[model samples]
Target: MLSQVIRYDGSMTSPSESAPLDGDELETWSALATVLEWLPPVLDVQLQDGWNLTHFEFGVLYALATAEGRSLPMSTLAGFANSTLSRLSRAVVRLEKRDWVRRSTDPEDRRVTIAWLTDSGAEVVASAAPAHADLVRRLVFDSLSAEQAMTLREISRSIAAAISDEGGWRPGR
Candidate 1:
């Protein structure tokens, strides 16, 4: 059983000494906080150390790989990668320098620029994918039973919806 602790005047107090919260509500909030604290660094280390890519860089490559024609408009790519345009521009410049991505004006709209993953970028992503998948499996999926995994997926979807309804951050929006 989980017990609640209350903080009062810089001291910790028992739940009985404090006003109540809905149990499920409290659990949901706590779980979200805990996961946020843990998940990012775990993902970052795998991307940074193993793949020589930052989390955002990995996201960009992954998004391009899954996108139509392995490309997207720079604006859309920024949104998909949850980065500001300037930041994405810098990242794309870096990738361009490495010959991993190419930038070009959209054929139908010269004013718009598109980012396309080069063959080298695709190869890098392919090489990194297995290690990334292994990390995800180890850090997340392997710990849960099949039923629990399904439940987690449902719960995460519901929470994501609630967060989005509240105007929370959304990539590719």
Candidate 2:
């Protein structure tokens, strides 16, 4: 539930950007905002309950699992996981404690650190993937028509491009 709404009161408007959202635009933004607010915790619950991992941890593990040789440089992993290096580093530290991931300085370039998914990490990812996929399908795909799904993909890509251009990570970059 959206607990608070600071509706436009015309108190801080400029000449060029003075107009508040139109009715259709307001409704669209509200729905999108609600989804943004709501989706993560739902995804988190499945990962936490079934695999004892947070969504970001699963993303890190999944990203490494799909990378060549089950590893990536720290910066590259952070990009793919759509996280900052510091955040990724903290998650990597937690995964290391579980012996699910390991970090090593690159043999040739000493400054570059690499994260590798251990065999144990692979096992956890393999175990969790299907259930995660099923939940996603049930919650998202099942609710959308094919055309709507395609539209969603395009919209997501456009939004991703815009956000990435503003200095956010773009997966597959």
Candidate 3:
């Protein structure tokens, strides 16, 4: 007769004897988990402390700044920011209030609205860009030698491609 016991940590201590995952698979899983845990906070801290922006806000501004005519359709901006339309709209409202952005209907297409980066927005982004790049280098690239950085980039791209193929992934989706 077997009796089941629950552990205090909410995990089962007694094993049913499942097969173990391969070492590479385990490493991949662990690395992904660690990245998920670390990436968001790092972004949040750098944006908030360094730039007075949230990650999403920075993304929206960055997209518009780099876009043609410093503008983009709201739908495209949403995709670029990896955000829902509603969320992007709200952020746009906040940016407008700050005089950092403007919204207007596209002259050629009344159904489409365009987000434009204002002079203030451009100034803010320009000021923040160096700090943001420095943070990225410190957090990611600076620790690696040039060859290692190149190798890591290749490995990351390959992994990204494989994951995209397996999961039907979309950039910013």
Among these predictions, the greatest TM-score belongs to 2
Model 3 agreement with the true structure over 105-132: per-residue lDDT tens digits: 9999999999999999999899888888
The best candidate in terms of lDDT = 2
**All candidates: TM-score:** 0.78, 0.86, 0.78
lDDT of 2 by residue, 1-173 (tens): 43343323323334444467879999999999999999899999999999899999999999999999999999999888877788899999999999999999999999999999999999999999999999889988999999999999999999877765655444433
After superposition, the stretches of candidate 3 with alpha carbons farther than 4 Å from their true spots are 1-22, 167-173
Worst 10 residues of 1 by lDDT: 2-11
Error of 1 at 59 (Å): 1.2
Give the lDDT of residue 2 in candidate 2.
34
Backbone-clash count (model 3): 0
Clashes of each: 0, 0, 0
Whichever of 2 and 3 has more TM-score, that candidate is 2
